[model samples]
Target: MKIPGSSLVRFPGNDPKLMLQMPSGGRQNTENSQLITAATVCLVVFGILAIVDGVYYHDIKYKLYQDKESILEHIYHTVRAVMFPIMMYCLFAHDFGGVLMIVGIGAVSIDFIMLIFDVKEEGRSRNRYGGLSNDEYMNHVFANTFHFVAIALILAAKPAAAWTIDPSFALGRPYPQVTAWLGSAFVAGGVIAALLHFWQWSQYFSRKVAQS
Candidate 1:
């Protein structure tokens, strides 16, 4: 049984000194836990893979750009390319919390949905580019599925990191307020990016009607 205030410490065998020397920082003590460290490393590795996937998978591997790119596909790629590096920055440098985390999660979820539109656009374009190869379909599917799983894992592993920033910081802020300002920028960027997609879609549809 664990003692009231003392922590349990076992190292190969029972040792009183090891137990006595243990720190009492609760969750803080677990900041550098093996699981968290592994998650952080995996986050970085996934971020790198996302970068590579953003660059090559859409165009070179899938030939998304071979014909006239669909508005949906272009916007999805644009947001994805912009966000991948910012996501790495959040994982490594900023470690934002609370509202920022919410915004990040919402943005990523929307991006995932946008990917569905992209895939549909691809299907419509098969007449132009021919049917997707087995490798192409698998690669696209894996990239789409892996990102959702990675996002879920990162959130699960670092729940504390998710809400580090307080809502109060958002109020009474000016240009130089770090969290508030930066969070606003992220929100604005997300909104603008989403709007751009719709705007492009409108243009694309209008052109299609004109051509018809």
Candidate 2:
């Protein structure tokens, strides 16, 4: 199934609706360049803070990552702590061509894997910590919302450069023929991630019922 948001940036030229019109001359260059700058700044600063948040929250505050019950959190944070910056670098430095697609696929794949570990950890956590406190939930909301907005801006600012299938492939440096295959990887990763989360949520409610 085509992802609702994927249509926003999926293979560039498939449908007119999916394709964003590129501004000509100075406008296009200005916007895309600005996007690159913003993406760079946000990725570096926020990414670093995110790492520190993990250390402070998980390591110092609760020691969750080191706790056996939170092994999933430990593993997920360890992997993503390494991978997130790499994806950001690929987008900022690589000019959002095939390299971005490659990294995007990797990000989604890592997220899917993390969700698996998360579900297991959640089951254990529910028994121990007893779900998120109001403040904790609010923090989650703020952090994730900020992250989603940053990613959205990056995509919106440079849709053509961001995706593999652009009509202006002539202008942007298209990747090798294998570039198309990366699209497939992107889709598969998203699907797996969605399914995994769906299953995880279902398990969460089931466990809640059993506990109650």
Candidate 3:
């Protein structure tokens, strides 16, 4: 019993209809659509929680930016801020193939490594505050869960051949309004993160000057 839509073929160019299709023009696989939608939803939640953690808890509540011990953690977030928009585009707004897909995968992989380092550094970073508070810790737990789930669903939805064939980077408006909204939000977040980092560094330098 051969599975329907199991044999994936690449559609040329950026036609919205160029997604995975059966050879005989049969019904398109709904599985990939479902998976992508699920992943998008997860990412939305992840983004919200991340903002709360970074902006509300870490910055406003704790002022981790002023802490020398938290510098490494902030560095991790700075890198993530730079990578976030690219990852969002590659994973959601744009369909990538061949070398582009490989590059997307590499970017996500690097983000994961940075996340691990950030998590490990959190202990030392938050030690002054008696470790992570219950609320912040729970926020991280949920954010990490959604982030990982989103990545898993994205990989599952993508065709294996996308990594090797038809090298293309084309608009993939899975949900145009949603994608646009997400793109705007992420771009804003990236900008804010950059500004916040600049502020952090300036404050650090000011303190050093004062001490000197």
Candidate 4:
């Protein structure tokens, strides 16, 4: 049984001569911790592989220069992982698929907003070091709002398309194909982003390590 307060390392209170020889801080740090650094390194390596696939996947280089909201470019976004497939299905105005696409987009927006707030609280994600500054806050707000609106438009497009194109035939459903196709894209996007971020972190720390 652990005694209350027994975890502390105690030197004898009465040992006058022994006290003279002791360091001001007590014994060296005595606890062991499970460090995630090793895991992060492994993740970073895997992320590099994913990044290569992402950069070249689906002729992404060409698509990047395409229209900002174009499906081809959206397919390459692979960032949120869902944006593309839902979009593709939406492109066809697959009724249910389009709605789900908006839902997914909403989720991404919410998460991003939460992240912005959380990061801002911690003073992160702006400038070279990635923290929010006053000037950048509006930009962040605008970016998120735009994406959120994009999702809404995407959601709205399908039903409208289905309704307008054919009164007797229904073309849209719950976006199964879009969901399936885009699932990996979303996963790959997350892995890629994490890798890039960690790569930057490692570089920063490596430089500091070298300097020291």
Candidate 5:
């Protein structure tokens, strides 16, 4: 059937409604980007506030040194800590930003621990992850590992050319080439694992969507 004035055609059984419907993947991708952007922006704001409060509220109870994370806090410590190194990585190739990398990971670790306490790991959380098979589990693991690698890459590059580098910036730094390589390895390994998971999820997606 012709769609309009143009000669573009589709099968008689083609669904105009489904075709016109916005792509599911498109929506998901957009939302994911939005989530990341919001996360980044909020973390930046949180960091600024923390630095300001740490200086001004050094004696106040709400200083970041004492401030905690919760659904309401809107302060994503992990992102704030990581972002500094990530930005430096984008700027330079050495360990100048090492502090941020270490702090970021620590923040994430602490945040996760705090999260464990602040929220139940059941109900919606459990349900969201409930239907996973081995493949899905692997995929999740791989995806997260890649995420770490991506973050690492953005944190590890040096601030200047490698022809001349600083020893102080070497072995002890968080964004050392070694650590970044390890993170990349994890990303690759995780991708392989996630592919298997993707295969498993495909079956579920196909069944649920019901092509015909």
Candidate 6:
């Protein structure tokens, strides 16, 4: 006797081993994999650039966390920081399908909007420091470019079915070794970013109270 929804529960070809197997050679499949790989690389580069800008320039060098002028920027970072881990989980940690994919897209879209606002507010926030340095400005340009490119590549790589409203979930990596490493790195980075932003906000609040 077969169970209800057994088809949904079963792996491809009813073989559990095949579920985690990488796709075999096909031009389209290969292209899609390449796109995902490139997007992952872009994300990694973006992460490094963000660390330089946020940690080295903003936190250590300028100590923007205690400045009232930087409060708006801090607010933007705090929100995006919280969303980053969820976005990374949905994008890299698993093969999200249907509604989950939609959720991931929504998260990315919101982050993009936040990025725009963050950039827009930087002029006012950094004006006290004589605006952004050339190095920091160039860093933002490259990081933003990579971020947009990654989104485009991911959207191109996804199939039409990924947009549909079907409920499906699975615990598996996108690729074998590389994806595992990328996913772990992204998720860890996201968590750390979130924590750092929260700490910055706390420090800022403390400074504000002391000044009062």
The alpha-carbon deviation from the true structure for residue 128 of candidate 5, after best TM-score superposition, in angstroms, is 11
Pull out the clashing pairs in model 3: none
Number of the top-ranking candidate, with lDDT as the measure: 6
lDDT of each: 0.49, 0.49, 0.71, 0.36, 0.36, 0.72
Assess the local accuracy of residue 59 in candidate 3 as a C-alpha lDDT between 0 and 100.
80
Task: Kindly report which residue stretches of model 6 are placed more than 4 angstroms away from their true locations once superposed.
Answer: 1-25, 171-173
TM-score of each: 0.53, 0.52, 0.79, 0.31, 0.24, 0.82
Segments in model 5 whose C-alpha atoms lie over 4 Å from true places: 1-122, 125-177, 209-212
Compare candidates 2 and 5 on lDDT and give the better one: 2
Writing each residue's lDDT as its tens digit, candidate 2 over 41-135 gives 55445444544555455556665543446655655655554554454444333335444555655774675576467645654663577764555
lDDT of 5 by residue, 160-208 (tens): 2221322122322234344344435433443443353344345544755
- Please write out the lDDT profile of model 1 over residues 1-212, one tens digit for every residue: 24465554333343332222233566744543434444444444554554455456554555443335444566666666456435433432343445555666666766666677767876665555566556567656665555556556445544342344443111110112343244355445545644654555566667778889
Instruction: Summarize candidate 6's per-residue lDDT along 1-212 as a digit string, tens digits.
Output: 12254322333443342232223348867798888889778877887887898789878987777788988888888788777777667766666655666777788888888988998998999998899789999998998888678667766776544555556444232554665477667778888888988888998898788889
Per-residue error at 179 for model 6, in Å?
2.2
For candidate 3, lDDT tens digit of each residue in 1-212?
22355643434545433454332322334667677778879988998998898889878898866778887788887777677666765666665555555666777888889899998999999998899889999999999899879878876776554655454644222444675467567766667787777778678769978999
Who is ahead in TM-score, 4 or 6?
A: 6
Deviation in Å, model 5, residue 25 alpha carbon: 50
lDDT of 5 at 121: 24
**Comparing 5 and 6 on TM-score, the stronger one:** 6
Q: What's the residue-level lDDT of 103 in candidate 6?
A: 79
Against the true structure, candidate 3 reaches a TM-score of 0.79
The Cα error of candidate 6 at residue 177, in Å, is: 2.4
lDDT agreement of model 2 with the native: 0.49
